[model samples]
Target: MSSSANNAVSSPFQLFDRTEWKRLNGHFSYHLSQDEVDNLHALNEPLNIKEIEDIYFPLAHLINIFIERTKDAHAVVNGFLNKHTQRLPFIIGIAGSVAVGKSTTARVLQKVLSMLPGKPRVDLVTTDGFLYPNKVLNERNILNRKGFPESYDTKLLLNFLSAMKSGVEEIQVPVYSHLEYDILENHMQDVVRPDILIVEGINVLQVNSSKGNIVFVSDYFDYSIYVDADEKDIMDWYVSRFESLRATSFQNPESYFHRYAGMDPQESLAMATNIWNEINRPNLQENILPTRYRADLILEKGSHHFVKQIKVRKI
Candidate 1:
């Protein structure tokens, strides 16, 4: 380990384990116990230390730092411009392929970040709440493609984020049902603008302004994160999730997905695989994954569902 050798360039694709985690390049981050990580990981199972050390710790810490710095910047800018220095919550976008564990990442960040110095009030809003009602999805012939960006009320979603980040005292975000698989009309969750806002989904970071549509959700994001993993691994994880849901979640008599419960294991497997191949996979390869490069940071996951390489955009 000579000085020059130690300083040699390393690929941004390097895999990391728990022991190798301390070396990740981030402005800030903190450690979590295996139990804590596991508790968070349960909601997003099949994840490992490599994922925690390499992907999450470094990421949460970097965000924690940015939130503080951005607040400072806002105060200075406001003072110079003779405007109110009051600031809205910092926004972080977490995007990834379905079943790639973005939910877990969001949850873990929320938990770990809560314990940070500021005890910053952290409010997480999942893009699922902005999705159009199931009836609209059926009419559009994209029920199978519900996770796509087009399935959402883009204008409303953008406006909501804009309001949240505009120093508004309180805002109402729509409520979505995992059972009904639809936005429950008129059911809104009111959140007072907190110190931090984490927006997560397959496409929270989507931005476009054309065809007379000027909605750009990510425009309000102070920082963004894209969770990364190999396609094959994601597919396997998705199918496994389906199996688990079938035994538990889908088995609830009143579950919206109850139809999937009694199916044979092989049938369920095919259903899951087909959905992944036909819908989720293409969305990942075409739309979702392409945005990885646009993120402030990218957390690449190894086959074992561990964070390997973390690519931070240069300042």
Candidate 2:
């Protein structure tokens, strides 16, 4: 609390501008085709080869270093214990507010990491699947709080992560459908002994201690990223994405939001704004934003949705 003490305080992260970070790309020769990059982009988010080359390639390189070092450390520890064991999958958690482009970052990393020297088996999973079913939420009277931490089946998700880290050969994860805006009862995603697993979600970095739970969702992550931007920018992006989806996916009769398809642009904008202010904004401010500093890496984005700065947490 003194002046000297205050002066001693410093950021835990080493910040890098776009040019500085791109220079760290080093000798890594990996490149994704423009078409492949195009497919990795999320709706209302722009991802081009330049972004991939400048931001993601260097990131992929850094992760590769972590992977190799982790394997080495495992071998050293096993030797010290005089026991042999398989290396567990390297898990990365990507956390951010809705419309902040975390999903696109996860997908891009999964692609780039898979292309690393040995073509490691990389799988990406979203925590959306871990969300409680719509019926459950409706019964609990928290259907509007769908993305909040309590809306997730935390125990099940913890067990899944536990099994995966314990070297389980296969695990079946429940699948959630955005079109239906609910968990699909019959569908499941099989994650079978991947070398690397990327978990992406708004709630991934949250620490919910109210349930008397000691272990957190992020505890299993070997590396974590927080996709960050100003709150106003994120809200704008959310509104834009909602309008785009209303024009496309919401037109499907079976889509949960199909009723929004007939709304005029102004109506759609108002509805999206209301939802953002009422639900997403509160969740972001209270839950998600507080966890940003916990990430090992932070991607700070500009209003145009391009990453303008990178922050690497000091070792």
Candidate 3:
């Protein structure tokens, strides 16, 4: 693409270096305890209190502003219609490639928002739970494509979101077990009404491509964030995380990856690389990364998993 074309493409967002982004943080300084920060940090994603103060605090504040604005708008609409509308949860969707540290971001956001003045009741659910059971994937001969968009029950996910937005007091959602590498059979968790609900996953931003429909899971989101990093950085993170999991989760006798726990380091590295090149990389390129443009904000990470830039979508 020409330089002008590239510039036009990038026009939708105003990029901020970490320093500039930090300036927007304002004087409101509330810090998370060490324990809270540790609990929210993901494996292989080293998160410190300083990082949260620098990146997440400002983000949480911005989201609260949007939430308040949404409430005001809803009230105006209700007044115009001369009817009281049921209040719905403010939904935030966090999307990114696997190993991009999106999970940590979701958890931290939930914790931070819950502490805000209104003390919103925040809950998080991952799209991983909506993935088809291993048995179903095996039957379809797509077990190897587990993290791909096609592996998810998109219709079921849509129904869940619809229920949430419809002001349903409670809904049962399936649970996924990472250790078992499958959806738990006959197991569901109840989600009660929440002031804020965060849905996090790689495919949360994916657009439906079949039947000429352009609808996306993100369409229901009041706000969306995409965690981004260079391909090489993500590849390294994925490999390192895989190795860490092999030593921990994979060590469980019932774990689906138990066999890999005893593999030689060289072999394990090779397997991780192969999986990245074959599964994760292709999915990121064709599905996940394309959706980044649709997000309200982008958290761009640099070396050592530190977020180096923030891209806020321009109105």
Highest-TM-score candidate: 2
Tens digit per residue, CA lDDT, model 2, 22-110: 99988666767788988999999999999988999999999889999999999999999999999999999999999999989999999
Model 3, residue 219: distance off in Å is: 1.2
Itemize residue pairs with steric clashes in candidate 2.
none
CA shift of 125, model 3, Å: 0.6
Q: lDDT for model 2, please.
A: 0.94
lDDT of 3 by residue, 1-315 (tens): 999889968799988988888789775468678998899988999999888888888898888889999999999999999999788999999999999999999999999889888688999999999999999999999999999988999888988998999989899998999889999999997789999999999999888586365556887899999999999999999999999988899999999999999988898899999999999999999989999989999999997899999999998
For model 1, how does the per-residue alpha-carbon lDDT over 135-197 read when each residue is reduced to its tens digit? 988998988788876788888887888788667889898999887777887799888868888
Regions more than 4 Å wrong, model 3: 1-10
List ranges where model 1 is wrong by over 4 Å: 1-21, 24-39, 42-44, 47-55, 208-212
Best model per lDDT = 2
Where does candidate 2 stray beyond 4 Å? 1-9
TM-score of each: 0.86, 0.97, 0.96
